[model samples]
Target: MSNEPVGVLVIGAGASGAAFAWSIAGAGMSVLCLDQGPWMKQRDYPSNGLDWEERGLGEFATSPNVRGLPADYPVNEQDSDISPLMFNAVGGSTILWAAHFPRLTPKDFRMKSDDGVGADWPIDYQTLEPYFALNDRMMGVSGLSGDPAYPYHEPPLPPLPLGKSGNTLAAGFEKLGWHWWPSDSAILSREYEGREACINLGPCLTGCAQGAKASTDITYWPVAQRKGVKVRSGCRVREITVREDGMADGVLYYDEEGQLQEQKAEIVVLACNGIGTPRLLLNSKSQQHPDGLANSSGLVGKNLMFHPYAMITGIFEEPLHGRRGPVGCSFWSHEFYQTDRSRGFVRGYSFEAIRGLGPAQTALQGMVQGFIPWGEDHHRAFARLYDHTATLLGITEDLPEDTNTVTLDPELKDSHGIPAPKVTYRLSENSRKMLAHAVERATEVLTAAGAVETVAEPLMRGAGWHLMGTARMGRDPKASVVNERGQAHDVKNLFIVDGSVFVTAGGVNPTSTIQAFALYVADSIKKNIETLFDDA
Candidate 1:
């Protein structure tokens, strides 16, 4: 059955969806957001369970193919070098992210103009600065001012204390004389806004049971609801429907009970992220727009970026607050974030440190590395590696290439019988060179930090947290799926408010910038509401 039409129907109530719904509703527009996953309760987070680590490695795992829940879809990653990992829940991946918050540098937006590499964004970082600050306050950012890497700005909260791991890494960076700054985390350091402060519980990648992490479910969704927004969970949208006039009608979805229903809307915003957005767009074929909605550019699922990563863990002789930790970045280095012609890569990468690992994860990873064998000396070897390790994650930037893509799998389908998304990605030679450079430098830093030994994984197949550039933004309809305001180039009333609109992938955590884009797009729509559909 068809439901009453809404002013805006937002698919995927994740980071972008939550923020966009809040802003649009504040602008006096009726907003209804739907998500395939259910709203997760803090009490139900894996950290609250007795077998928290077990669940975190399983059902709450980052890979949807491994999670294999009813709400989840299997991503075909066998052919790809790295998996496109994501969460289906309201907060999306933020529920399990390390919360390393950093803004995109000015050069990131003008890559082509400055570095002659990737396409330049329609709007620059200056155009998005105010929105970034607004998002910082909304997301409860914790950071110090005077960061040379970014333009002048202060986070809403103070910086998190750098424990032993952070201090040790800081010394190494100081010795090398590089640019290192305390991480701007989307987590509360001190109690604020009814949320508790972080206790450094370490399993942030699993779930922050303390409610200290700023997942949008707790950050924006409540405010949006108070501002007259409606959110219906467990509604997996099959496809966005179109009217004869070539404007968005709404979407056809499967409700929690698995019943088919249609919801109508005046405007449709896609916040389904890089992979899901393209999957839905390609599934939405009609007589008016045959090559899926807004696919006239033939670039909907092209230019997929995975941010190919490298993990380097140093084994120290002494424990460094390993018992209690912030598994995410304590501080990050931007020394290599800018392009260097001598480095043989157009863009650069960032080094973020992992202070510690959970007992189960450490054991599993140690076993895989043959550091902790199944024999009697396992305890001794485990003790040697336990609290004495510091890992540096190299976030290498993946340039946008049309060869990489997110297409619908012909043979694989979800429980509801919808074709699954297939990821076909290959690491560019530039990225390979960057990873090599990053590994060498990282090894040097670890050595300077007095590490007895170091282990390095040049490329991680599972490190696909930042999925971007699937539906790139551009001024020309023939080049990109969406315009500067995130409006679909083909369908004026349709907008994409997720990472799908990212023109170039930056070498940092993208959640903060993703939220900024959502707020910016929402404001852009409100400002141009009168003329938004005139061109249509």
Candidate 2:
């Protein structure tokens, strides 16, 4: 660790961290970031090998508990209805993501005023619009203009080819007269900023071999490094140390060789995801702040949002060749996105289309769904659903609930002996209603699109990729952990720029919005740099 204090110290070199680091470093301040995971190389991505599918199912699994890599800390998911999934590499979960980037709508920011379901965010959609646009320019988004579902903003590139899976799903949406649009993807449809175009590789959940998918390691980190920003890998931050003034002095971390070290910084920024961020705060107990630093509101690990998902799959007669294109981003319908009081639910969901699975996954899923029998007819059953199934994943709006939480487990700990996050989550009544409605509507779309056999999974345990709403933002210091500018309510000069700061989880994905929020916070910090440490 450096003896001299840096201008800003960022923890977790993930999506939000990379974006904020790049933006803040551009303001000419010496920025240094520390990540627990190593830098992922594009050449070593799973897609480059013939056993890509197997690798994705094993070592590169999305859930840290399943993967159990050296850099990963095991998350206790036994108590949760759905398992939390994330990656810890330089680009974070974006490394294993499908690149289906979607922005939260205007109504998402004002859930309290609009639907009376959740608390409203201090900042609205309009406040982050410019930052969203700026991030799209840097990260590169692919979609057509005039999406009516959102405020007008043209994507940087043309949409990816809908392929047979999307066209088939579009026919269903048209027949049902529902709202459907091509996904606005972070995966490049065409080459931009020296990256090559996507070649329609099947396994997007694994790392992108062609560098078509815009993981921050390839996109933001390179730029940030060029601007003189420094990032250290394989360093696990154990806790934050505070001074007598109750201000953040720096962090205590385990280095690459498992040696404990201290690094001082003038300002500390946390870009760890919802679970990780809150876990860190709750673990950082100090004399000045016993309950945890910046946790005076007693809401650090509360209000955890997983965006409860339900998947409905339909088996068709003809082959859709679904795996030929991007599996994660296809056409999706927002026919049930907004809150409709008459629908018996406060909020709604989005039916995002998913392509068919691989040979191994298809067989495994078929057996779990009780369709493919073993012994005699296993091959026959597997062949029927291999490339002939289309799935619609219902991404629901999960409201904040204090009961659903991320607490430090007493027994569970990482290799560094730091407490692991224990997730205790359950689906709320509103989520249950919204999920049922979405499944029914999605089944209709499948039937209209000529499905022969349809099966519904009300809860997708493996689909808990989007985590948000832990350390939420609000104007009232008593109710929130952070302010509108992403500054911690109790700890000035310390900021959070991750999904933990989301007030509510919208129906769509939160990645794009997370990046926008990070950039917005960096911009705000630059503007108030002089008075940033006054509270200290």
Q: How accurate is candidate 2 locally (lDDT)?
A: 0.91
Cα lDDT tens digits for candidate 2, 1-536? 56467889999998999999999996767899999999998888888988888899888999998899998999998999889999998999999998888899999999899887798999999999999999998888888878889999999999999888788888999998899999988989998999999999888898998898889999999999999999999999999888888889899999899999998988899999999999999999988889988889999999999988899998999999988878888876788999889999898998889888888878888999998999999889888999999989999999899999999999999999999999999989999999899889888889999998789999888878988888999989999999999999899978999999999999998999999999999999999988876765
Tens-place lDDT digits, model 1, residues 42-156: 8888878779889987889999988998879888988799987888898888888889998888889989988898899999898889899999999898999999999989998
Clashing pairs in 2: none
User: In candidate 1, which residue pairs get closer than 3 Å at backbone N, Cα or C atoms, i.e. clash?
Assistant: none
Candidate 1 local Cα displacement, residue 157, angstroms: 0.4
lDDT of all predictions: 0.89, 0.91
Candidates in order, TM-scores: namely: 0.99, 0.99
Which 10 consecutive residues of model 2 have the lowest summed lDDT?
A: 1-10
Q: Which candidate number has the best lDDT? A: 2
Give stretches of model 1 more than 4 Å off: none
